[model samples]
Target: MDGLHAPASLALGIVPRKAPALDIASIPRFWFDNDPFKTRFFDALSLLFPEGEKFFIACVRDYRANITDPELQQQVKDFIYQEGQHGALHTAFNDRLKAQGVQVDRILAKQRTIMFDGFRGKLPKRYTLGQTAAAEHITAIMAHRFTHSDVFASAHPVARALFAWHAVEEIEHKAVAFDVLRTVAKGNWLIRAGSMLQVSVTFPLHVVLLMNHLLKLDGVLPNPQVWKDGRRWLLGAEGLLRPMLRDYLDYYRFGFHPNNHGNLAKIQRWREEFAEHGDARLATDRTLHG
Candidate 1:
């Protein structure tokens, strides 16, 4: 394996095996509860999913074409399965927004047209994989920062759990795509470098676009609460970005190792939190309608 190291592999030896299918059933319910700010944020995120899903699907398709190692191919297949479930869960959540009279379909349609179909011809498979790797790195960092921050810690129980669950999985699978590309591409720095560059650029652009969408949807552009929450979220990005960049450099120097351990204690804490307050019935409730 291109990025595998014995020491790193040993460190990760204790990490729990990931299921082939994500337990979408465990996704928290409080995420749906109506607070104007939270709902606005959810709507903005919903808008991003169609494009994100397409991007993942594209990368997975490309990998299927190029990958030859059976074990690595199986890992990629598992990653795709989990990503597809993510798309399904978010799509369901988007439907909830539409139920609340949000203009979700129109926005997603436009995003799909532009981000998926329109850009498909311009971006090549290697570039797509690079972007995926970059996004994964960004999410891994965000997962770490979110576990440590009070902003996430103090949120509604369900909201906090939702972010943490996603974060844990991000950390768990962070190396999968990079491993795939490293194996197939073999010392291809364009994918690695391009991914890093795109991560730095596209993440902020998504945030800006999200804020703009939220402002137009809720007419809360100037609301103090919006600014306060937005500021906190942006500040949280620093914690995520710094360590992630460090890890990216480390990966280049040490090579990709699947055995690297993250803050597993945090994942445990989040699971414990979920067990305490997470009601399966409540989480499954569609009563909120949005």
Candidate 2:
């Protein structure tokens, strides 16, 4: 219950709800506002989620039996369920990309080889948990920004529903990994801070590189207009990336906790929205293969 607010309690059902079906085929290549750059940008993030969330689940579940608080223990179970559902959903989405002949498998293969397999044995447990805590902060803030902003307003309905739902859950259990870290790793501030620094560099670098790779595959990387629009999409007044920069800085503050951001009202609203429309199918008409 360290970071659980009243609204977040609803997310701790102990069983993870399956994500509503998303019509991955209907999601156009440039799904975000119909802009290729923006679409590719989000695709870059999606590429990371399956593998990344798996690592996060492992980091927290490693210390599951040690969590003494009943509320937190239940939250951890929900967290694992949520993250597992995320990985499965994103995997289905990525499969659609591959069927569309997008070069996504190359990126995913690299992720498996480099991130999942390569780093699995090399990193220490404390470091891994610290990294999980730091990554959760990043995703949680991104969730807040996604929910509050109009960034996804013009996105394809399929992508919008998927992201909006994911964001809500991200906000719901935003503190689970950090709580696990606090309990298991003794909340080592130095390791936590260092992991953030590492994440700040590697996370963005990986996304940008993947975006560029996807764009290059699509023959849009060298186009001047693409970069111009992409820059504004990320850094402009209504840009999604720039505003979150401040949120990212909040992690460096001493005694930072994700609940400090406080989005209960937003969570409540989204919870209602999900309860009403959360079960919508992703792409029932089309068959997807794993």
Top model by lDDT, which number? 2
Clashing pairs in 1: 3-256, 8-259
The local distance difference test score of each candidate is 0.55, 0.74
Model 2: number of clashes? Answer: 4
The lowest-lDDT stretch of 10 consecutive residues in candidate 1 is 281-290
Off by over 4 Å in 2: 1-15, 280-290
Q: List runs of model 1 lying over 4 Å from the truth.
A: 1-43, 149-151, 223-229, 236-261, 268-290
lDDT, candidate 2, residue 98? 83
Please give the TM-score that candidate 2 achieves against the real structure.
0.87
lDDT digits (tens) for residues 56-122 of candidate 2 = 9888877888878998888988898899999888888888778766777777778877766665678
Model 1 Cα lDDT, one tens digit per residue, 1-290: 11111123222111332322324344333343444555455457555755686676677577676788876676676667656655665676566556555677777777666556755557776666767776776666556655544434333454444444555556666777777667775638766776668666765676567656656565776667776775564445543234345555654444545336345554554444434655422321211101
Per-prediction TM-score: 0.71, 0.87
Question: What's the distance in Å from true for residue 19, model 2?
Answer: 1.2
